[model samples]
Target: MKYDWVLFDADETLFHFDSFGGMKLMFERFGVNFTRDDYDAYQLVNKPLWVDYQDGKITADELKIIRFEGWATKLGITPFELNSAFLEAMADICTLLPGAKELLDALSGNAKLGIITNGFTELQAIRLERTGLSDYFEHVVISEEVGVAKPDLGIFDHAHQLMGLPCKTKILMVGDNPHSDVLGGINFGIETCWLNTQGVQTPAGIHPHYEVNSLEQLRMTLFA
Candidate 1:
């Protein structure tokens, strides 16, 4: 089957979230004088806040503040200071995943590309623009801006509408997460491609139409 519009997930799909370079900058900026264990623990604590934020159970500002607050509290640091540092570090850190540019370039003219991410509009925009990938996409629908997150069929419907596609079947939703990306696409009747970078098994019940370990495989899978 041929797809006209290709929707993508931002963070782990196009870029690595655990960018060590970015983390180093963040550590220095925040003056976080903790051991590696602290950093690891902080990430463990902070990840669920993002899930909550995406699920619409928490506000954006609350998410921003709380993640740092939780981390700071655990490490006996001031939340305000950590929050300030985090914001600055986030703005300065821009790292693209492998094959990101190549994949975007390959698909640019061949299909209508769009970004459907469950992230803040400003941050996602900054990363995309910094990576010089903003031009490849026709539309970027971020959850915070849209007032809805993925796994919710509404956002999928909105993206489909924005693409001006006749139906969901004509579009391909590609991303790293099974719950958010794959299940969300399936919920909307769009063909789903699991960007299983880690080579994990397809979870118990969910099924993706296509499964690939890298974006580089996309061209061959879809066109060849």
Candidate 2:
């Protein structure tokens, strides 16, 4: 029952980022005026930049500017305008996942909590602050800040080092991704709990110490 630290994944775990809304707002804010088709194209082009950014192949700023530029060029808009609009829209639309506050409240004083996310520092910080979830974490490690992403042992090590917990066995990683969150924790020899909100079967060759259907399930599992 004794746990020294718990690390969480940010995007789907802590917050549900409305990427579609944010992108639509970005077009409106930038005055580019794109159609649904255009937005679809933009999403296709922009998603891979995040993977590259997480892999340390691109800088955070590069990923942002490139995503904006790619979408703008495809939509026949100026990249600079798109960039400004996207930043503004993204800042406004970022929000927390359902039951995030309640779960945080339940875990707050009971154990040390932190976040390990694969995202740009600016985007992650804006989301965390806007959602008021930043206060719950003792430490926050982002791939953009650390030059490494999840599923990479280095990021896990960085988080563990920052936590300064005496025992790795007492640390728990909770995340939605099988390859990233669960595999990453296993790689580092830390206990892992998969947040399988979608109820999907565990993928081949990966296993978590626990599986949770929802944040509420997590609360009950931890405190009940």
Which structure among the candidates has the greatest lDDT?
A: 2
lDDT of 1 at 196: 94
Runs with alpha carbons beyond 4 Å of true place in candidate 1: 19-21, 70-84
lDDT tens digits by residue: candidate 2, 1-224: 45777889987898776777777887676566667887777778777876676566777667667777766677787765666566567779777667778888988888889999885565777777778776889999988778788888989989888987459888999999998899989999999999998999999999899999898888888876
Output the TM-score of candidate 2.
0.87
Candidate 2 steric clashes: 1
Which runs in model 2 stand beyond 4 Å of their true positions? 55-59, 72-87
The global Cα lDDT (0 to 1) of model 2 is: 0.80
**RMSD to true structure for each model, in Å:** 2.7, 2.5
List pairs with backbone clashes in candidate 1: none
How do the residues 1-224 of candidate 1 rate in per-residue lDDT, one tens digit apiece?
A: 28788889988888777534555677765565656676777678678987886677886667767767766776577866666565456657667778778877777778888999886665776777778887889999988777778888888878877877566667899999999999989989989999998999899889999999988897678868
Worst window of 10 by summed lDDT in candidate 1? 17-26
